[model samples]
Target chain A: MAAEPPYLELLESVDSFPHIDISKTPYIEDESSSFYQLLLPNDARCHGYIHPSVVHKLAWTASFQVSHSIPRTVQLLDDSDGKDTAAACSRAFYEVIEKAVDSKIYPFLKTMQWENYRIVGAKYPTVQLLRSAARLFGICSRGAHMTAYVRTNDGIKIWVGRRAAHLFTYPGKLDTTVAGGVRAEESPFECIVHEAAEEASIPADFVRANAKACGAITYVAKSSTAYGDDSSLMTPVILYNYDIELPEHIVPRPQDDEVEDFYLWDLEQVKQAMVNRAFKTNCAAVMMDFFIRHGIITDENEKDYLEILTRLHRKLPVPTSPSEA
Target chain B: MAAEPPYLELLESVDSFPHIDISKTPYIEDESSSFYQLLLPNDARCHGYIHPSVVHKLAWTASFQVSHSIPRTVQLLDDSDGKDTAAACSRAFYEVIEKAVDSKIYPFLKTMQWENYRIVGAKYPTVQLLRSAARLFGICSRGAHMTAYVRTNDGIKIWVGRRAAHLFTYPGKLDTTVAGGVRAEESPFECIVHEAAEEASIPADFVRANAKACGAITYVAKSSTAYGDDSSLMTPVILYNYDIELPEHIVPRPQDDEVEDFYLWDLEQVKQAMVNRAFKTNCAAVMMDFFIRHGIITDENEKDYLEILTRLHRKLPVPTSPSEA
Candidate 1:
């Protein structure tokens, strides 16, 4: 039998995926980088797309396959038809992916061989088709994904896990065990419950409710070797948040095959772990920041965590390194 | 060929079935008396098996079902169990529909039978099943059921209508074209949109945002006919406030089949229409009161209507010649 993976080892491995070079990409980073911020426009007309480097990094880490090569078709709209605005935005977004792929930003990135990504009917980029392969394999739309904060006697412990190596995207990367895409007809609440059961072995009722909202994240990257083509859109993730309080008697058991192990840490411990590079998962870091701001985790420890995040972000690898130029 | 039926004539003749005497039944009343100054409870658990007499008065006047004939074994908490407490609250509400074949209430006022009366599902006593029905009927739930105050060139026209006569209950009585039940799976916003479309034929885009949450009203009644059989519960109504700006060219058109006629009533006209002894609709009176309290209708004519309502409520129906008890 394979030995159980250590928490930090799994987290670091997930974060080590190659990122796209963004040094030359003109983009503005905002203070409110929460998932909800993804919906707000970073500039005029269009919200800023993620740098190709970041997309490449996410694709590398996630192990998503790239399938197609298409020409870049970015169109700047001064003023156009309101009815076609969503479609226009999506077309422009697709063009950015084309550019990223053509640039060959990350040679090692794999392509999403499955035709999972399609234009969301009527709603443009806000909606997408569920890939049959993912559906058959039980990988659902990201809209159904939920982040649950479980409070234990030891403090608040959230269950995060690394994706399996065989998975197409985010392989070996840390992610919420209970987060994934919701199916076409499924409710967000129902989807989260199903995810919790499948990923963390936690009962649906274990989730507590407080503030809830929907958000999205977009990024561009080169196609992976898994794809027959060279150019493809990288990873675009949408996430929803729900706060749940579980009974003390409920114990979490991560799926043995899908997840390597589990850890129960207090908020302070989790914060320290995040700063110490003990929890290197990008999603985990984002969720921790959310928890601290929402008063779910409040203390002097939050100040320290924030400082660490700021410093780490500064030193984090950029898509275009000085050596590359 | 049959001549096209006149709207009012068709509505009046639709539910010509004889009325059932519900007063003798074992039923629960939400309040002690209609004249009593008591507020309806908001909690779903506060329901009681009511006297059929109260059911008849409340349900008929309110234009909804008053039967205690539905199966009782179904659990109310099934949908809510282990989910959020709010989901529990929403799912915990259920009414016992007395199963009486060939009963007057059954054919004329207990089930949704007429297409015009179909506000996307059975429009009897609750928003839950009604909302589900809305989805089944393919109506846009978010734009149909809720009321909107549209600003026309003539001023703000509050659209109102009488329930279709062939409806299971509340036949021929005035009802809001929008406000209705929130489904088990739907939010308040969704319910109103469907209601608006079905009842008033209002287009979806016409509805404005920034809805003022006006709260809710619940009424229960016991069957007087089958005293030991079952009781009726009616929480058929939910209220919301929305404002829409209309272009001058857009003339309000009431769905001839669902509404008796379109009334572009100003504040004074609305007030006068509400208390006109001949108006004879409970829902209209309630809506008028709502508008008045919210200061939507402020004019001398409204004061006259209020005076009329006060006088009408104060005087009980007088027994003539000692023949009536």
Candidate 2:
């Protein structure tokens, strides 16, 4: 084991990844707004151009695709002209994307779950989204998660989950106790309660009674798309964090197959597991955030506390699409 | 009173100011970034110029005074080079400002309580700071406040304190149960504890133990400075909100002269007071945030819910002095 760093002497050594600078990533295409990219994992590049006819058919009439490079165009909507078309565009676009995923992406249909959807807007007042499947397609989706822990007499204990092997991504990796994506019109609180019931056998009523609003963690990162090609997908996510002080006896059992097993570990065990990369990368970040907020990882104990905080929040581009405005 | 507007049917009608178009405010000068302007309250103007010598003497060495129309250059630091000079500059600037406050500002400063002195940079880290007196000067200072509430049997109850009639600004205005400026090196949690003890006579230990972090409310507004002139000083504020659930029968009594009286008002009373503008403008926003977050105010019941949420969060500009890279 590596010797403890001078800053984080209060905690054990951590093997963590340095933050990637998302802002520095170039659009790579003229028509692309800094907010999103086509995420053509197959081409090994961003800024892919799509046919203008496809965009028009999808009702993204206001969005003009750059025909420069590959024939993939990004969705850059002008706020005013785009508002009326949002619902129609999302419906049309996602339908094609869904079909593409069903064929191109593997074994995603069974894991599909309904989520309140917003295909073309910044958070609020979604244009005609009843619901949509939330699974492998979430790479391009905006999402939220909740982190929960229990206060013990000695210290605090966090419950971590191991994803079932059959899961599409990060299978068998560690995850948060309760997490779910925000469905259309559902608030973070509502999502958390619903997730608590589905992921863990925890009763919805119990979660509703006990949960407390902590805040949120937001990030935009380039991620892997449908295929594990050299190309990447740029996705935006906002994790609505919650600190639940679970009762000692209320052990969470897997309600669905999303989670394999649960483990209640103290901070030390969590640190060790994190160092071993036992947790999902996103889950690790969330756990680290919880530690920093709770004072477990202070400036005295962590050298990169400031950098960590800075990395945790990304100033998302203002949504200019008429629907978002 | 006339029936509440259909928009706020759940609450009473508000005779409040219309939303100010902050984005329309022009940059004061060529050198000055749009972030800080010579706030012209009710005047259709911007780009005020100030002397370079004043900017230098004020220890804004890393910052250049924009001499367009702005009479006095405001201290807006650029991120890169200004990072290192932050501690020293904040120390120097606040020192002179403090002296100016003592000698020139006004006669009554007994209300000035010690605030952890961090004058430079936008919150988060304060390298080296001693305590400085906190008061009306907070307008020119970065401040944080905690809006604490308790869960009553019926719905929810908030602790409201009427400011003493003798206080400098907004005398006798209603305020949050526990609110104060974050002193240098004092975390929001610590400041809340200290303020709870000083303002409400709430036990520090109890506050430290029970208080929960809900989130924060941030805004940039025009404020008054030492020289009360037509050119308002643009002030930026971030209120770190907290929700504390106190056990029943644990009434909060005013411990200091800051608070005249404390009332445990339920949701209805709080909303009525908010509509009546009994609470300070900022305090009213904070309470509205609390109500909205708690689901007491929803899109179904409130017309301005989306607008309110949008107004609550403002994307502040990055602090960059001319020296910033």
Candidate with the greatest lDDT versus the true structure? 2
Q: List model 2 lDDT by residue over B1-325, tens digit each.
A: 3333232321222212122333343443443433333221122232222223223323233333333343332533433353555555355445555554556433333344544555333332342333332222222233455556667667678889999999766789899998887766766678888889999888999987877665455555544443342233344455666777787767788998989999988776776776566786677767765765565655335545444453454433322111111
Off by over 4 Å in 2: A1-91, A98-116, A120-140, A144-148, A183-194, A208-215, A225-232, A241-249, A288-315, A318-325, B1-116, B120-144, B185-190, B208-217, B224-227, B285-325
Lowest summed lDDT window (length 10), candidate 1 chain B: B316-325
TM-score of each: 0.29, 0.66
- The candidate 1 chain A region of ten consecutive residues with least summed lDDT is A33-42
The runs of at least 3 residues in candidate 1 whose Cα sits more than 4 Å from the true structure, single-residue gaps closed, are A1-153, A162-174, A182-190, A204-237, A276-280, A293-325, B1-325
Could you tell me the TM-score of chain A in candidate 2? 0.71
Interface root-mean-square deviation for each candidate? 31.1, 7.3
What is the DockQ of the complex in model 1? Answer: 0.01
Candidate 1, residues A12-128, lDDT tens digits: the string is: 332332332222222224322111111211121212233333433332211122211221112234122556554444444344444445566533322443223332211233423
